[model samples]
Target: MSRQAIGKANCFHDKGHHADCTLSSYPYMAAFGIIQIILSQIPNFHKLSFLSIMAAVMSFTYATIGIGLAMATVAGGKVGKTNISGTVVEVDVTATQKIWRSFQAVGDIAFAYAYATVLIEIQDTLKSSPAENKSMKRASLLGVSTTTFFYILCGCFGYAAFGNKAPGDFLTDFGFYEPFWLIDFANACIAFHLIGAYQVFAQPIFQFVEKRCNRNWPDNKFITSEYSVNVPFLGKFNISIFRLVWRTAYVVITTVVAMIFPFFNAILGLIGAASFWPLTVYFPVEMNIAQTKVKKYSPRWIGLKVLCWVCLIVSLLAAAGSIAGLISSVKTYKPFRTIHE
Candidate 1:
């Protein structure tokens, strides 16, 4: 029953349906599923052939790509729109409204590492700085650099461990055999992560709905009633109509894709990585260029431009490589087709 519910949730959340909401939650869920699959096959550890490991590695690479693309997209958007407001309130509200979109953009860069490196570090550093904090720039540079290193490290580890035989998705690879305690812990982590992702995407939508409701309702009852109606299955589950509806949609979409896609992990990873380049590498440089344009050009400025160009080239190459892999994977899709005749 729980599994079925999860499947339903994922179906409604996948791309082409509620893409914005899915963008935030899908990566984490996909990762969780992959891990589950790996652990399941632990008893068959000796039977874990080289081919399986290689497939797993490929999938992981794709996942990293997905994250990278997301990060790049977010950073790029921020750079492009830096001039919108000068006041703190305006900035806060604007940033909040677009937080999911930004995160989605950030996901394009390097998923876990990019978020940790660029978004988390840069945001924290900037927020901590005084108006005259000259060190903020240096700090951000160091932070992003560190992030890149970690991403490379993880990718290398995954490749070395699995090579070309890695599983297409983590869960299917492992057979979902982790101990109950560990499984419980993992499930908890997945649930919270999903919630966080949902909040990131749904906050803006919720706010918009709230405002519209307020105008139309003039009283709280109408808003409450409408909110109930908006959430479909969740409303039936006796959960908080808002949260239930939001999360249910996410879970359903992910589940559906997990079941349908032959190499779900690789596909998700590819999407993520492609998104990251623009968000992390390309956007930040562009933003720096825009921010520094008013000041006199210096060696640092020239260096930044050169760096931007390099990042752009690298990002393009990475994206191209990912697409090529996807195409190759598609060409060899004999394993996943059903034999109905």
Candidate 2:
């Protein structure tokens, strides 16, 4: 989704006018998705170590550039004057509207923090150790702390710089000035970062399906072994026909959905509203409460339980808002409209 968004932004940046890039993205998405599907065939998670590191470096690079740009604006007196910041907390709005907007923002934040859903799969890639959980805890604490600091800085500074004029993607909103090359480089980093990130997340789905297929099929015997094909140059590089078909289908489906619905923020809102409370908030709290087995009437238990319910209720309401937002977006939606459109 972001790749397509960036592609569209590049259209504006290069041509100084909006051009629908969705049709062009058809081939690009197909090619990239296929690359990801093929890369998923590598069973050893360690093989992705370098790519993951590169992705992290690129992510940090772009984030630092973003922060520096915002800071530059502040220092140069280019910061806009806008009263929109923190309006969600203003008393001028109706209570219901305030709650709805607040929850909507919560949904976005939850979506951004949605890595918890896949953190266990990532942890499984670690070597087995009695202290594995402790290691993961320390790693999570450090990672979260660092990322939170950057997120806060970027958000506060970007809002201060652009205020109501801020684009959904700050990098794409920059003018072609002295830092034009830097802006382009930052965008390139995002694209390359996503290429690796996609596989890391998509591999879990591939593994799940492949495992189930292996369990049910019980061998390459589901089809005649004759169904396989070998590439001549890559000696013994045999590809199972069934495996090829199944994984390719998964890639095609995902790519199609991404192309058809390129609303990145709306999709994130939906994902967060749908899964964040259950996976991130409710389950962990319940697990802690169950493990501790505090008295049901005690303050700790009661407080935790209440928090769980609040998270659940808030998630549901946020989901409703997300659905509403999606429907409204569709009313103005074009299949591949540029930002100017």
Candidate 3:
């Protein structure tokens, strides 16, 4: 997505808005994978404070810019065609498309609000000065509320501005043009944020794999060894052969998959469907119940179980929708050749 943004901005700047600005993103994608490989050496999530802070700021900046632009478009009375519900079947949509799209929307929205996958990881870093649970509660409340508020603003305004014709990715999908520089700047911000965001998400998985390997083979020198090399200002840098190999391969594989699919929304929806319920809902809920010693089949337990069932149904529907979307995209897309050819 970040690569797409950069390519889109450059294309729009060089070619005119009306020109054929479709991008072949292989080069940019490769470039990104290489950069991620280098950034993967940043050790662990605890050391990612700078990247996390940058990602947060950039996210807010781009989101605000997108919302402002959408509102401006609506205010200027440049709104595109809109329908109260789904797009008109006779005009551009079919009944199947509508049903699938509705399902897709559910998945997309689920994915959008799914941010607690790293909740425990975050709480692990909190200071003990304040009660951890209280601080965590306050932080989660503010974070979730603010994020939802901005998300709603973005969705509502973007829809009002572009109506049924709204681009899937407003910032990079030719949705805005007149203020090309601002659009470029927003895209740049997205790239920067994603660069950091990718590491934030990937580092945990890296550590998990490395730690497991070390635990499973404590005597394997290749897997257990950590060589330190002295650096100028940063001091000694620890290099692990296993980590270097595993992380590099992981990044490469994911990069290739992204290159092959290149359908961001569908892929994201699928991932959300696969991980959201398990990582965000099931484990946490179960852990809470166990911690509080809630009796089985009691009111609280039943409520939590019902919630889990509901979320499971949602995840299943989302998975179906995402699979349908991917199939649809594959029929239209020519991997790496063009976006929608």
For candidate 2, the lDDT comes to: 0.70
TM-score of 2: 0.81
**Tens digits of per-residue lDDT for model 1, 189-232:** 44434333333333334445545765876655523533223345
Quick one: best lDDT, which candidate? Answer: 3
Overlapping backbone residue pairs in candidate 3 total 0
lDDT of 2 by residue, 1-341 (tens): 33544655565556664444433455666677777678655544556787789888988998998889889988888876557544434444555555555566677777767676567777887777857778789988998898899989988898788765555568754522336557767777887888887776666666677677777777567432433345578444545566567667887788778767766666677788888888888888888878878888899888888988988887887777677667767888776543333
**What is the Å distance of residue 288 in model 2 from its true position?**
2.8
lDDT of 3 by residue, 88-172 (tens): 8767678887777667777887776676756667788889979789999999899889999999999899999998888888887
Name the 10 consecutive residues with the lowest summed lDDT in model 3: 1-10
Q: Against the hidden true structure, what lDDT does model 3 obtain?
A: 0.85
Cα misplacement distance, residue 298 of candidate 2 (Å): 2.8
Give candidate 3 regions above 4 Å deviation.
3-7, 10-15
Per-prediction TM-score: 0.41, 0.81, 0.94
Error of 3 at 48 (Å): 0.2
Error of model 1, residue 272, in angstroms: 3.1
Q: What is the Å distance of residue 249 in model 1 from its true position? A: 7.1
Model with the higher TM-score, candidate 1 or 3:
3
lDDT of 3 at 297: 92
